[model samples]
Target: MTTSFPDPAAFVGKVAFISGAASGIGAATAGRLARLGARLVLADRDAERLAAFAAQLATQDVLALNVDVTSMASVEQAIAAGIAHFGGLDLAVNSAGIDLPRCATAHYPAEDWDKVIAVNLTGVFNAVRNQIPAMLARGGGSIVNVSSIMGFRAFAGQPAYTAAKHGVIGLTKAAALDHAAQGVRINAVAPGFIETPLLAHLSEEKKQEAAMLHPVARLGQPDEITSVILFLLSDAASFVTGACYEVDGGYLAR
Candidate 1:
């Protein structure tokens, strides 16, 4: 395969796997990749949603799996099955994540911390570890982990979410450096508060308040982040690895 990729992304015929494919950024990424002509392996804990969404794509080259990103076994099995279904793996986007309700670090329940870390941080680890070897075996490939503005910035009353997102950045860097030599390009995209289902728990007033935090005075959309992800996955970013692209609309700038 040629390292040369097109400007928008040369996804045609590429076998791409994505976690958290039921909704939000994961769903948006999956939809876009499908349109771009990539064979898709979509996974999410929500089996019904995953199947429904996968079918809506109207593409024959799709495999929907109910995967729990926190489990190494689940993630490993998903990867192996995807490769077997599609023949080989070429790229991946690990976007499966969750956020707990606000709670001070001192009062944050241990279980909540574990849950947040398990899905938001360890989840990425499970995917990356499995994705790397698959890609390496095929010569080289790309992986994009979704980090957050919270990865570098602080969010009060949300200790677990803050810590997990921060860990994602560190993991992305470490994994990328370890595999860049082997032709696996790993990177992260840190989006500002996005108007995804993850924020459905917040009140309208709270959502507005959250929007104001960005200099753009609005939240990001899944497509905004998805576009950057496509670029990073494409050979367009062949020289780029171990980097975190902040799509925060100036949240980090503040």
Candidate 2:
């Protein structure tokens, strides 16, 4: 499907907070939104990388915060800093996540399971929990929680990641229902095998194998996923909420 966005200033004067903004999809989204005129709060655990990226953007329009999403206190502090800097927040995207070493569920390390759940599932809850009231104060806002195609389907060696992503979808739906009447819209985006820093360690052959998993015969790009996220955060998707949009290159279609 061809989509042409004519308005480059669709997000002008808007305040957007994005987690995991150090690199990959989050970094791509941050750049895109900034170009489209949105004031940004970029949060991530990688302080150096986050700072470098934020430095390239207009300093007056961006606040780079070092945040560990797994800790509720860290997330709260980041949100507080953003609000204090930008005055208010109008949109947010939760993209901080982690993947465990491949292993059967029974053989998975308890530590890995705990770490994954803390960063992925509870991390989203932390962001959402704090984001809601800020949006409520603004009278309305939008949120996009980044899930994965694995949220609905099973990956042989990703028990914790799968479970956490699935929980994100459920959380998104519940939040949508709870806030829609008050004008806050919550939704999710499930991306499939995107070419990001997460996959930078894969061998060329392994990357090809992953690409073949999608019917499109190739992996997706970060900007491709960013476009969908931008749409959800903008007024263009005013009627959208509690829905999970799959930008998976047909990976789940099969």
Candidate 3:
């Protein structure tokens, strides 16, 4: 028996940039695109991990950058360097994010809130702003930002995470409309809790509790979110823009 995958020719000669590529959904998306024939620029704050992961890819056509998304200069430089290396940019996945320790809204630490918003919200802004010009230069391109189910729903003890994700959806929509006519299509993926490093610290019992929160009764895998991200970044979704696709397993339905 054979397992089939999407046609790789669709991504031939394409160049892709992915932040947070050291692990989880970002790594999954990078791996998928690499397999689909796209040259990659992989970015993460973890230099060691990013380098190791890039080395393990099937292709040598990978540029791994250690980037702190919270820094605009760092993101801009990475994109510039990637374009210089790959000739141009055709696709991007902005998945870099961080969560604050759970706390009440009134008791949330100002510094932690700042850090979360910096990495989760401002970091995405930095990536998008830096990437748009490069994409526009190539005539047009596709971008997928990783939001969360919390973007639309309220979660206790996660005020910072919730707000940043909500901002990402709004930013995705606005950026999409602004560049839609110019040929650049921007969309967002709102994923449910997945088996990512972010959730690795949770106890096994807590993990199961989270899974049961969804109708599917199981946690989503990183590849599951990556699949939707690939669709949004592919020509198959040519007409898609300003849209936030929920990749949740019926979590939002109830």
Q: Score each candidate by Cα lDDT.
A: 0.93, 0.92, 0.93
Q: What does the lDDT come to for candidate 3?
A: 0.93
Candidate closer to the true structure by TM-score (higher is better), 2 or 3: 3
Q: Write the per-residue lDDT of candidate 1 for residues 40-61, one digit (tens) a residue.
A: 9999999998898998995799
In the range 112-173, model 3's lDDT, one tens digit per residue, is 99999999999999999988999999999999999999999989999999999999999999
lDDT tens string, model 2, 1-254?
A: 33346467778989999999989899999998888889999999999999999988754699999999999999999999999998998999999887856899889999999999999999999999999999999999999999999898988888999999999999999999999999999999999999998888889999999999999999999999999999998778888999999999998887
The global Cα lDDT (0 to 1) of model 1 is: 0.93
TM-score of each: 0.97, 0.96, 0.97
Q: What is the Cα root-mean-square deviation between model 2 and the actual structure?
A: 2.3
Where model 3 places Cα greater than 4 Å from the true spot, the runs are: 1-5
- Report lDDT (Cα) of residue 96, candidate 3: 94
Query: What C-alpha RMSD separates each model from the true structure?
Result: 1.8, 2.3, 3.1
Better of 1 and 3 by TM-score: 3
Pairs in clash, predicted candidate 1: none
